[model samples]
Target: MPKQDNLSGYNNTGSDTSVFFLSGIPGLEAMHLWISIPFSSVFTVALLGNCTLLYVIKTEPALHKPMYYFLTMLAVINLVLSATTVPKSLSIFWFNFREISFTACLVQMFFLHTFSSMESCVLVAMAFDRYVAICNPLRYVTILTNSVIAKIGLAALARAVLLTAPVLFLLRRLPFCQSHVIAHCYCEHMAVVKLACASTSLNNIYGIFITLFIGGLDLTLISLSYVRILRTVFSLASKEEQLKAFSTCFSHFCAILMTYTPMVLTTIIHRFGHQVAPHVHILMANFYFLLPPMMNPIVYGVKTKEIRDRVLLLSHGKNF
Candidate 1:
């Protein structure tokens, strides 16, 4: 269970204070309790998986490199992203507590998109790491130095902040005079903005811009990196060398799909899918937030040899 909880203690919806009522899965309110079973379980698994990944990355000295450091950033971002949205959703489902203050919802929107963008930026960094390792092996270390990675991390945060901070001011200007009941669970950008009475042309424009900027640009860069990586791998003299080169990228490619596909689909569907049911949109939103967090470690562990070996050693009570 994660999401827009009493985080920062912003849940007082008094008669005077403006608050948003979250209608958890509009059409399936009756099934909330039942649905929360999987939600809570997935949340638990996501936290455990990411924590375990962090622990493994920390303890294994052999895993200390740019690739793993980018992975570490991804893991932390996954943890925060899941923490931002799932628990509150589960709370709403299980206990029928779906009230969230406007301030709290704003905080939720900020962090939700911030970490999501961070995840995207981290993926791009990972793509670049793979690119250098595959396409420019000799210069990999010099290109992805520790200080450089630190700069990349900071740059990611700065970019996310630059894009998402404006959302707060834009939201503050719009007046929610009609119903405060948001059809979905958390305070998603478009979802919250849709409840506004004023013109949301600016908000819509910004939302679309953020989606394309983060998802579109990052996807293009990653795709270019992989395309070059594949061309480099194919040029290797031996079949074994080609396989080895491609194997290194399998986990990262899976991560790219896990993260971008759902996010892009959700944003597109939200913008254009008028015929879709409310619960369907909400479920897709939940999946967008939850899937990557839960599956990332498993994908990495199973696909990448080092993490898998370290995890197995720890599981088997052996020195890692």
Candidate 2:
């Protein structure tokens, strides 16, 4: 149960708490239609691209390897992340429906953060898969078997839930005496926490701690895995073999860069960029959530010959 704060002056009690107003973009009310155009287009492409990636992986037997399996998991996480935030964002833009119920807001916050964290974990797992394939080819299959892949996916989800569940509890305890208008598009953790009249030091501390430890630790492991992979690739006698092995990791590396760069910049902006305009923060937050999902499929489809050929085959009315 949440520890309710004193509400003597505020008109609303616990039962009377109402919806929160999600401001889509702080100062661009008139240009919402224009904004919706690009946002809707990106959402559509992300949906189609990720869904197609999943379908190709499912029907193509050649893509049943561990790397593709991790790719499938990545696609699913991207879908969830985009689905949870984009529709509501579009609704806010198109229909001016910006009111999110308090409970629903919390649910959205939970799922968005959960899947984002899961995506990070999946990327780390994919890095490990690449490392094994390049540096220890003899044991790749034995190491990342079907059962082990399942366990990795499960662990990713479990880690996300464990880290995000406390945020909902913490939000519930805070007394929202200030205006309920959120300055961003969605229910971001810090955005919502900032609205609370009560002390938010614990929430801020925990959020930063989880972000640094989970995200930082995952990134460190991925970097180390790639370092080993590159070292092994360089040791190969033939230049062709080195290029072939490194090519396999290029798409995943791009995906990581897309994911973490925006995330790191947005975190820095939020914590330190006090003089920055409100709309800038909102736009950066949107990029942090939107860009990776919109680009991941395109990256893999263009970079991976197997997926590209399968997609081309499907497009030409041939068997995948």
Candidate 3:
């Protein structure tokens, strides 16, 4: 297996394996150690904060509503998202070993995008939960019962798995006889697809399909939910009451902002910002991956009164 077809400079890696080398942040290898500072810090915070959020939501009966249940789904997604990429990235950053088996790379890409889609789905669910809570407060419980929440979760899992399955299948059929050096920290879908020697028109089409499925479909639905929510909030007679109603949605709005802003911005830059530095694009793309998981718990912990109080009690070593 002459795996060094396109990677001439990396002759030290030899030329007889089915592995890919993860190039940690193009044009920023020297700064990997310094870069690890923020990555390590954010990854650590993502783990602790999401774990705490899960613990608080599970143990505190008051925090078990539809909003919090949707939040629990988000927390679990964050844990998986960060766990999938961060440790592998840290290995590249700290140990400088990037030999991921071909199968492992595909698995990494699978989990990364699958959970990313689920994150988007969970966000849409949260937005709908808020819409019902504000728009139909009288029937909120009746509408989003425990069984409905479980069904929503199952639907999210099904959608994610089904939508992402084709991308992996498409990639497996391509011949990766080109350079196996995957630029960027993770084996992102398009990044791996680009390594194929064969024409990737099908893989490209699948990439666009999943991107539209996630970025297009999810955003439209979330937007629709929030628009309805805003209409409901503004219909209130008192300004104070309107503000109070909207406040309940503040944390979810923050989650949406963190989750989508960087991704949308980076996608734009990638499509149009040809003059921009490569590292800048990679940093922006990676930002969307880590920021949401790390900030979700913090935003919810501060904005939601119930989660905040419980988190505080736990911080102080007091009984919940």
Kindly give the stretch of ten consecutive residues in candidate 3 with the minimal lDDT sum.
1-10
Question: For every model shown, what is its TM-score relative to the native structure?
Answer: 0.94, 0.94, 0.94
Report the error of model 2 at residue 28, Å.
1.6
Q: At residue 53, give the lDDT of candidate 1.
A: 98
Residues 1-320 of candidate 3 have per-residue lDDT tens digits of 33222335543443634677888788888888999999999999999999999999889999878888899999999899899998998987888777788889889888988888899999999989888999998999999999999999999999989988888888888877657788778887777777777899988777767777789988999999989988888889999999999899999899999988987888778767989887898888888768998999999888988888998898899984
Clashing pairs in 2: none
Q: For model 2, how does the per-residue alpha-carbon lDDT over 101-171 read when each residue is reduced to its tens digit?
A: 89999889989889989989999999999999999999988999999999999999999999989988988
Candidate 2's C-alpha runs over 4 A off are: 1-16
Candidate 3 regions exceeding 4 Å error are 1-17
Quality of model 1 by C-alpha lDDT: 0.86
